[model samples]
Target: MVSSISLSIDSDLDKVSLLARAVRALCEDLLGPDDQDAVELSLVEAINNVIKHGYHGERGKDVQVAVGLQADQVVIEVIDHAPPMPAQVLDKAPEDTFAFDEADLADIPEGGMGLALIRMNMDEVEYHSGDSENRLRMVKRIAPRSQ
Candidate 1:
């Protein structure tokens, strides 16, 4: 069986919580607890990036999230009309380990970790933009349920 849900929200940060909850509910049975949490976290991170960076903190802009569960995987797509992601960000690879200067508190970055988190959590990640629309797609593989 397949299940899916879609939500459209304004570029407000407050709206992301409710949207994440809806996606989690829709995916409840299709994923294990850990995977479910990962998906929710990834979903939140994706939308946050779209709102903060893509929309430049603008309100009332449109952001859409769609999640679908198939027999073997979960598909998540986040769409927006804001500017496309930086070329370096789109081209960079996700690192398995996080590296930062522990001794220097100011060296820690306050932002720019969302994409890395999404890429680390999801099995696959892709992003593209054209026609004034940008889309970020992520996938997580799951084992088939036993009969």
Candidate 2:
């Protein structure tokens, strides 16, 4: 069985944290002791990306967040109205993947770590965008170790 919740809010960084908190509460309830801090951190990162990069600092734009809990996993989806990021950008591995040093941080752009962190923490991550909306869906499998 799967339980789902949806929320729509302003595309603001400050507000995104509230969304993250709400997700954390829902995840904690569904996952019980199995959910960890890393999952919460990843959700915050994704929400931050949607508010910052996805909406490009636009305050009034709408950002939608959805959380779904299944028997063995948790899924999160973030939707926004911004233009889709280039496929190549999403495909290329972060430079940090090879060697994450201060030099790499200097060379790479800021805010790029959001997706990298999401991919690192989540079991699956997918991007879908159309003329009207851009969507990021991430899933984290509930592991026995966490339980």
- TM-scores for all candidates: the values are 0.92, 0.85
Candidate 1 least-lDDT 10 residues? 90-99
Model 2 gets an lDDT of 0.78
Model 2 residue runs over 4 Å out of place are: 32-34, 94-98, 103-105, 145-147
In candidate 1 the C-alpha lDDT for residue 81 amounts to 98
Q: How many clashes does each candidate structure show, in the order listed?
A: 0, 0
Number of the predicted model whose TM-score against the real structure is largest: 1
Q: Rate the local accuracy (lDDT) of all candidates.
A: 0.87, 0.78
Cα error of candidate 1 at position 114, Å: 0.5
**RMSD to the hidden true structure, all candidates:** 1.7, 2.6
* Among all candidates shown, the one with the greatest lDDT: 1
